[model samples]
Target: MKHQPINGQHHVSMLTKDAKQNLWFYTEVLGLRLVKKTVNQDDPSMYHLFYGNRNGAPGTEVSFFEMPNAGQTRKGTNSISSFSLLVPNDEALSYWASRLDSFEVPHEAIVSIGERKSLTFYDRDELTVHLVSAEKDNGIELVEPWITEDIPPKYVIVGLGPVELTVREASRTKAVLEDILGYTQVRTVPSMGDSKVMVDIYETGKGGLYTELQVKEVNDKDRERPGKGSIHHVAIRVKDVEELTEWAAKITAAGFENTGVIDRYYFHSLYFRDPNHILFEIATDGPGFEIDETFDALGENLTLPSFLEERREEIESKLHPIR
Candidate 1:
């Protein structure tokens, strides 16, 4: 269709029962850099944690909002069921399996997902995460991984991969992806675990490993009851505020209710929900994690935007130290 402003994934936001544990798992165990230490703008009392590659690139990040004492997720349909992180190749998969075992983290053995190998695991909050290989992918943009003594550059996570959404019916969501969002239906696969469950693959932006979306259709299932460990939303990339504004108009004209452009300090965003009521955000790629903090000092301090700087003391008082 017309020039598609939507790029690949921006970041997937999830809920965590303990920010401290979440920080440990994502940074120490998973080897992602703690890109930003900030509070959720919507609720300054709770902390919002961001983890990503060295640059905190748009497609590489996954964020969390702390919700202390929130109960376990009641899994079912109509949810952003899982999100995958991109690893370099099959060798990286093998390395991650060993690393995870040493850390006493439970993960399934590596298996083929489409044309690539994937190792599925859960976080402290039981958030489903897949470490998918980009071995067969040629179109995914490369980025700098966060390397540490335990995790070398070769085995580090590069960026976000496909995100899966489970719903009772897929027709409406498919329409939104294809008709409104300009994503093309690439293929469908019977679930590796259950042949009866079919997954439709849709791709936007560059239309490769990093840009894929999988929607699993299950006709009979109750809606999910989200609490801790549940995904809050999945955001896709827009070039900037100018591109985001155009996307807002397109989404609005297509009759989908949306949050008209909001300045998130780091980036501008527009939010909307799919037919299954799964939250989706379109976010810009600039004014990123390095705006306030130096490249060397990111995630080292409790950072607030200019608007929230005045309330830093009050915000810090409410948050439990994530270190």
Candidate 2:
């Protein structure tokens, strides 16, 4: 162990066309609890939705930037394609396959990558999602799941897995992931049936943070265009504000542009972009979703950061109601 800075993925944030539909899809379809319901701090006119486990655990978060009017995403090289979650075993994967089928949500049959079994699907915004089945010996993920009536606790998505980043080539992107972020390059493997395409695997602390780079030759004009159905950023985790600031200093020293430090109320944040312009965030583990509200009452009401406290009514007026 080379003293890992990033524990693993904290949360992945993306854009959605409709807040209500976003809510329904993650909560009703996927069975995630609406841990935090707030507005985008930068553009308070829009919403920022967060979905996580029962108590809004650290690695279980998947947030969104609800920008209904924004243009739709164009997938290509240099894009963060999908967000994945860890499932306990092959049986849990089978349960989810049938679960999504019953909901009429389109999903792919179980597939294999190395020794791992995965079930792929898309959310309402066309965001790609994967549920990877793993055994305890394969590093059983942080197992806190949002328990609800219909969704068995066994099948609830445990935590964030490898996020797929399809870039123009592997060199720059791999350097950023491995060199700058302190991730180890596990190996380079062939992608699908295309012997030309190389999928590079990078792993962080233990087995939590993983990223797959789908490297292919592409022209500058064909680079991915971020929009409605695209990922905003993937946040990696630090233990607390102290570790976060230290990482910030290291990131800046490594000749990368970082947003310094920000107070996100729930956690401290530092934002940066990789070599190919894919945004990345480094957020603290706590004070978490329970800072202001009780665990049982989490996400029950709209919450605002301290800076926006006085303008609550104004912010609420500009946004659409989501249940």
Candidate 3:
């Protein structure tokens, strides 16, 4: 059976130690708006903060879970090692370099990836993130600070561009991405080989920038541990709930156990893993970040899923105070 093409990248969330620091980095530094602030349904004391363009649109949203007292993660083989963010243009690259310096945030010089220019930096929690400025061909609108007098209200994120993982062997994981998830092997970019094997995977998009996976070969795979500084899971987008269900079954049928459908309030999700031991999630685009709140008031309150609605007070109490 022919399935519908996967939608654009939806969102990516990370687990952090300090919610306030992450808020400042994503909102104040990177200029993403705080679209939602809610408590984790499973553990309410920890806050789930969502940041993105002004309205917290589906593809633009990037969320974080503030878990206090969590140990740092050793980003080695067996983890989603690093994530990249897309900027508008090269002009934005210069703007971001200056901004990071002015804010006293240490960052590396602009580096070239394929035809794009990127600035590599780590957040307060030590998660590696990159800002890439490339020609926008996906038709998704972006808020260019260098062009606007005021920060724009909404900028279409165009989903995840690429994620690099450290792994012991790339062949097994490569099979999962190709045979199971249906990603095509585009080409190898040797320019990114700084002691790692960087492979690109093309997913739902016009110019093949939606999803790319790079795996680095390492001697020890068991050294990596999941914790605060590592990615919990990298999510790929599907059209809607039905698409998500179909994809979940596909995953299960392929002999991988999926977490099943999970109502994330903003989107439904199912979790699984590739052969290399990196966690992956297939997420829906329906009932987006704009569901409970207006475009203008997206991050104004601590929103929760209906399952955790009755524990609002308890969840609020558990969260570390973020001023």
Which candidate ranks first by lDDT, i.e. highest? Answer: 1
The order by descending lDDT is 1, 2, 3
Name the candidate, 1 or 2, with the larger lDDT value: 1
Q: Residue by residue across 1-323, what tens digits does model 2's lDDT show?
A: 13345777888999999999989988988888999998889989988988988887778899998887878678777777777877767789899989888878888888766666788888777778888775533545555688888877777777777677776665787787778778876766644323355666677777533333333434454777788879888888888988888888888988998899999999999998877777889899899999988999999899998899999989989988886
Best by TM-score: 1
Model 1: CA > 4 A from native:
192-196
> What is the C-alpha lDDT profile of model 1 across 3-79, one tens digit per residue?
55478899999999999999999998998999999999989999999999997999999999999979989998999
Question: What lDDT is obtained when candidate 1 is compared to the true structure?
Answer: 0.88
TM-score on alpha carbons, each prediction: 0.97, 0.92, 0.89
Superposed by TM-score, candidate 2 places the C-alpha of residue 132 at a distance from the truth, in angstroms, of 0.9
> Looking at candidate 2, what is the lDDT of residue 139?
42
lDDT of each: 0.88, 0.78, 0.70
Relative to the true structure, candidate 3 reaches a TM of 0.89
lDDT of 3 by residue, 126-203 (tens): 788877664644543454222123333232122345677667777888778767767667666642325245555445
Q: Worst lDDT window (10 residues) for model 1?
A: 189-198
Evaluated at residue 207, the lDDT of candidate 1 is 83
